[model samples]
Target chain A: MTKQNTKKLSLAPIPYFWDRDYTHQFYQQVAQSPIDIVYLGEVVCSKRRALSLQDWMTIGHDLQAAGKQVVLSTLSLVEAASELSVMTKICQQGDFMVEANDMSAVQLRTKFESNAFIAGSSLNIYNQRSLDKLKSLGLSRWVLPHEHNQQALHAFDLGNVELELPAWGRLSLAYSARCFTARTHNRSKDQCGFVCDQYPDGLAMKTQEQKDFLVINGIQTQSGTIQNHLEAINDDAVDILRITPQQNNCFEVIALFDQVRKQQLSVTDGQKQLTECTVHPISNGYWHQKAGKDWVA
Target chain B: MELVCPAGNLPSLKVAVKAGADAVYMGLQNATNARHFAGLNFTEKQMTQGIEFAQSRGCKVFLAVNTYPYCHDLPTWQQAVDTAAELKVDALILADMGVMDYACEKHPDLNIHLSVQGSATSAAAVNFFAEQFNIKRAVIPRVLSIKQVAHLVNNSLVPIEVFGFGSLCVMVEGRCLLSSYATGLGPNNHGACSPAEFVEWKNTDSHLETRLNGILIDQVAKDESVGYPVICKGRYQVNDQIGYAIEEPTSLNTLSILAELKAIGVAAVKVEGRQRSPAYVRQVTEVMRAAIDDCLTRPDKYVVKDSWNQTLGDLSEGQQTTLGAYYRNWQ
Candidate 1:
């Protein structure tokens, strides 16, 4: 491993709707991990209220006490006025940084005079001018979209703000108003009994040939294979690496990334261990400018 | 409500204008627009003639420069904006904030509408675009119920336009990456979804298989009808079942809710295809124009005629239409 400094590990907000106690216990464990910053709040569906704003704040404070930065994330799809109100409330929460997943969240945070906020990947900041506009709107950092390649990132001299890449976990591919999980159970979105909670990682979907295809979370569709960038930490194009929380062995995955990022482990050995840490198949194709499901290595 | 129709070529623009469309929307041949097909959209000279022809018939022309511009391709999108302003279209429909900023600063007097690709489903999102870029109107995504649409109409500072008829996009526009996940190209960047160049169809004695970038999207019996391989609409296996796990192939037809949409103060209704033929433009424009006229003339007694439904159904994908997310039950 090449020695690279100023790289940070972040924990993306949980995309699933786990029960309250299980969520708390998961965060409690996260506090002990080597993650430098932890994103908190629900980003998939507004209906998943197992963890209310107050509950998230409590977790944020606890994590902050554990010497990790905490960021409150807003929903990706905003359809109802009620969802906007919740986003407004999140923006009003004092002192914690906010991640604007949608334009609605950006508007609310700007209205609340947020000084430094993160632009979530779903906001789709593609060019330098959009980044400049977002910077004028008080953006401190932004995540690279899933489809952008290394060549695209080199085009922008993002010197004023840091760049974060989604280094690990399944890529969130799409979002819809209809919940596929609810549809899978023959339930309407309005009458969904929170069945998404039953699948901690999301319901797996495969092609007719039994090849893994996608994961159907509540309103979000994610890649079936986990994206592992353990081999690309020395790329030096990004300042931060984000690891999305998974159902099993997430901390173990984080530890491997920590060791690799710190040059305590060889990239080849870390890549091999990462394959064993998660049950799902792993790919790093998006970083290599291929189909997102392709394992470039 | 204004009847905004689509026109992929100059002939289609003329057909739509003659069919009584209030306005027609088209794109350039490049990736500056969403319908960036190989043989679709207009050249600069064709667009000039199209604008003049539509305006002479008292129909407006809106230019769509709606696709997101990446770091290396910003010049092309900026150039498209300059061309739209030079061509004197009635409005510029844009989705990218970077492009919006350039248009707003370079051509402040030009009218701007938020494209559906902007994916601003709520008033907050619309207001952000309006407040930041001075957008005059917004086309909401096809992911909201009527009640939600009404709420947005009531709260938004700009006029709201909703999709009235055309193919359905199940996922929120601009946010979906299923195509890029499979083909490495999507509507946001490439301005094409499941781009045709990457699609392949294989025939067997008993079945037909559709693939995108070598990934199997769907395989069906030979006798069954086949549609374009949209990733969301393809059949897949989930656990113990094999079916359309995400969504079935369908189109959105909101003729039944024309009165309701007008009652809620929707300023315009948009048709969602630009790669269709001139015949399609003529038929759909005439029906929508007649329907809007009837609804405006007598909102209390306006009804969707059976013949109109029959025509639209025949033109729809898989010969079926749904209320989409407009009806609460569809959600």
Candidate 2:
């Protein structure tokens, strides 16, 4: 086992909406976890008002007190003036690092502070040149988009900026203006009624053959299969492993990853534990440069 | 407002120009451009000919070098930009920041239009491109409503271009990875969505099944009309109901809202079909040109003619046309 103390585990901000109390409870549990970093705030639809800025700040303070790095994430798609306003406020918070999910957020961050920020996965950084360009714009760390293969990562000289890879959870495939969860219930986006809360992880979508395909979480669509790269935790390219928060066993998954990273458990044992905890099939094909749905194991 | 039409080849470019397109956008026959399909787009000689033909008719030619380049392939994208500049194309439509930076530094005088794939929905995002790369125009993503478009146009430092017609992408461009998830090819990395090679058509006893890289996208009866198995447009079992869960397979037709678009100070209207035939380009370009002309001539008298609607409807995907995200109801 590689004794690398640099490997850190981060909790990705919840992409779906849970009740405010549930979110608070989740973070309270996270505050006691072995996770190194916690990303707070919403990255999906703005309609999800489970937590306000003050709520997130309070949570951030708690995580900070718990000896964890807190990075506030901005929205993935900034279409409205209201969303842009929120993004600007988030970027100018100045207390914590901001994850610029959209270009607007990146622009706003660069405008407010020359200090480094994390470029979220939605900001398409396909190559080393693009990465270098973003680095020039004050990007300190970046999450690799789930679509990029490991071969692509190996080819790039990522420089000083830390590389964070999604180590667990469903891949956020796409986001749209229309709330798909609303559409599923034959309701308009304006009248979505926060139905995404019903499926805390996300609403599962299947093919005609009853094969699990996608999960619709309001406007965001994710893979039905949870991406588990616990076995590949020792990759030198990765500095941080991001585990997305889910409704169930999210903390256990984080603990398993932490144990694996610390050499307390074998990769196979970690995978077995993760499989036992997750309801969906596990996949690592995106890391293997194959179809995302394919499970190499 | 100007009408920007797409040209997959030299013939399509000529048809666009002759059919009244103010500008025709195309790409090189490589992954540097978004429409990097087999036997589509242009060669160097073909691009030169396309520019000459468009210029002869007092129309403009824009080269689309819009795809993101990996570190190993950065030189190819830079070369494409350099070649397009050398060819004296009217403009270069680009998406990636690195490529935009290269274009700005290497070819300072070349006009750069931010591609729709850049996903610049907000004015701040548009201004960022304009301020950094001196982008002259920006193609807005198809995710914004007309009200949102108006807000952006009001605040934008650069001129705004909107998708007036063609197939609608339910997700914001540059952000979508659904294609990549399903077929290992996407607009950002591979420059192709639902790549032709991954597409398979199977005819069962009762239905015609379309699959992309072995994931069943849609299955339809023999008599039912079928569209391409673009993952977003596919039917799926959502909430125990089977239908187009994401978006129905329909082409965007903003002809009805031409007057409103003009009033909102939109600099140009873009037609989004490069993989389409010259005939498709000609019909769409002609109808849009006529509609824009009529709308400009008399805004009060402007109305989407049934004939124009029928012409576009004939060429629409799935034999259906929609206002898409431009209409708030569609969202």
Candidate 3:
């Protein structure tokens, strides 16, 4: 862990839905890529069907073989009976670290108590007390909520705490039991013919004014604006810079973050390259105390 | 068999009780409850008088102290709960777990109805409240289909109330922070979503552009109707096609399906607006009351009608209302 903190990037597993082969192919290349840390498992909807536990473990092994730290991530909203089993399986790990997306994950991590686990952005970790509580429960690192801009993150940042700083990604805003992407296709969550695989990026949502509001990934709904913060990486103690994978140019996005983190490139250049990866436009609102769509740059 | 109504003001409480509400729920003029606003909600004196009037009319008064208590603001919540008990209100509708814990511990005998803000969609979640805090009933989420309700009600021990009409949330209740992210005011903690403070309307050439928190939520053509600038009510684009990608500006008018919900063993039908006008309250309550009566009188020949609009007057227009997940899944 100490050796790899030197300007490396992690390719976050595709938070949206993807086919098994696409996921396999994605991780195969990621294992071979410059990404130092690779967080695997489904973080959005439980019913995405892109990867099961066996497939995830296989991919995790492949990534491990490629010389990367594999962290298994849990679902953002753990509601139904089937979801509980998935959450339990993710926490019942020995080798890989786990990211706690919901309170269920937090509870499991609390039982492990001293064993370090990653806290997710969705956990509503606002003040230092909550951060201290997570730390008391063995919270190792955290992916900042997309809405937490540099300012709020800095305010909420436990200055000397052990949690890792999630440097960037498309903010995972909300989650629901209803498969929104499936609902868009007039399909039920149970009977839907796995349509989320068709759009690897996400299904874009527009307002009545025809403006982009959000994107439906699977059970998860994310801000349409890619809440990236590679620009905020200026002479700080950011341990891990997490970037969620898109359909294309994930490797390039990771490379850009690495460059910015190392001070090898200007923040402007790092963010400019990020805009081309095809997730959505870049936003830094959570840092600005403004709307998630409102970017400072 | 109770009708839980919202009273955003003293007058609304009067209207609600006069219009046949078995229970009327109100919050303080602060964020202690989910309907926090500047001019809306009751003052302490207004609440006391409102409670007195409701009790006189065989109507119960439920005080809402539903917002999650911030770590430092527990005293404000504790005082709000204490005040509700001191007023000797019929019941207290609560959402926050800590507040429920406090209320149950302090005033064990005060009736506590779980607020919909808790988002108790499952029986287990409801049972968690019921068994833990002695919660008598729960106001359910608006997302459940009637069939789902039938199944849920058939299996549950606690009585459930469904939101039969009014504001519909695009996502699940009690969890959304989109409003606070967009505006400083959020429904979860702030009790107002797309708060009026962030709303701006402009007549732009051929459309009424309704903006909330500077986000262009809707741009209605001269002929179209524009509803509130809620995130879910906004129109959006998918695959280059744009319209109301989430929900239309239509109100949740499930009065047509009141009998269907009643058949599912729903103990109460909730009307969604407390912030609406007295006339609005009177009209909605009268129509809902009439609908329920109609359900009992002509069970087989009952027909849901659109005359509730006469009560709302011009508050609504050209809404294509689907049963919205209460029958089929939302399209």
Top-scoring candidate (DockQ): 1
Instruction: Give, for candidate 1 chain B, the lowest lDDT window spanning 10 residues.
Output: B238-247
TM-score of chain B of each: 0.99, 0.98, 0.93
Per candidate, native contacts kept equal 0.80, 0.70, 0.22
lDDT by residue (B119-174, candidate 2, tens digit) is 89899999989998999999999989999999999999999999999988999888
- Give model 2's clash tally: 0
Docking class of 2: medium
State the fraction of real interface contacts model 2 keeps: 0.70
Cα lDDT of model 1 by residue, A1-297, tens digit: 343556889999999989999999999999999999999999999889998999999999999999999999998999988889998998887769999999998888887754568999999788999999999989998888888887888888787788888989999999998989999988889999999988999999988888888999988999999988766578677888899998788988899989887778888999999998778888877778887888987
Mark the regions of model 3 whose C-alpha exceeds 4 Å error after superposition.
A1-13, A32-39, A43-47, A61-120, A123-166, A175-193, A206-213, A218-220, A231-241, A259-279, B68-79, B90-114, B124-137, B150-159, B256-267, B290-320
In candidate 2, stretches whose alpha carbon ends up further than 4 angstroms from where it belongs are: A1-3
Ranking by lDDT: 1, 2, 3
* lDDT comparison, 2 vs 3, better candidate: 2
Evaluated against the true structure, the overall lDDT of model 1 is 0.91
Task: Please give the range of 10 consecutive residues that has the lowest summed lDDT in model 3 chain A.
Answer: A1-10
Chain A TM-scores, per candidate, are 0.97, 0.97, 0.89
- TM-score (all chains, Cα) for each model: 0.98, 0.98, 0.81
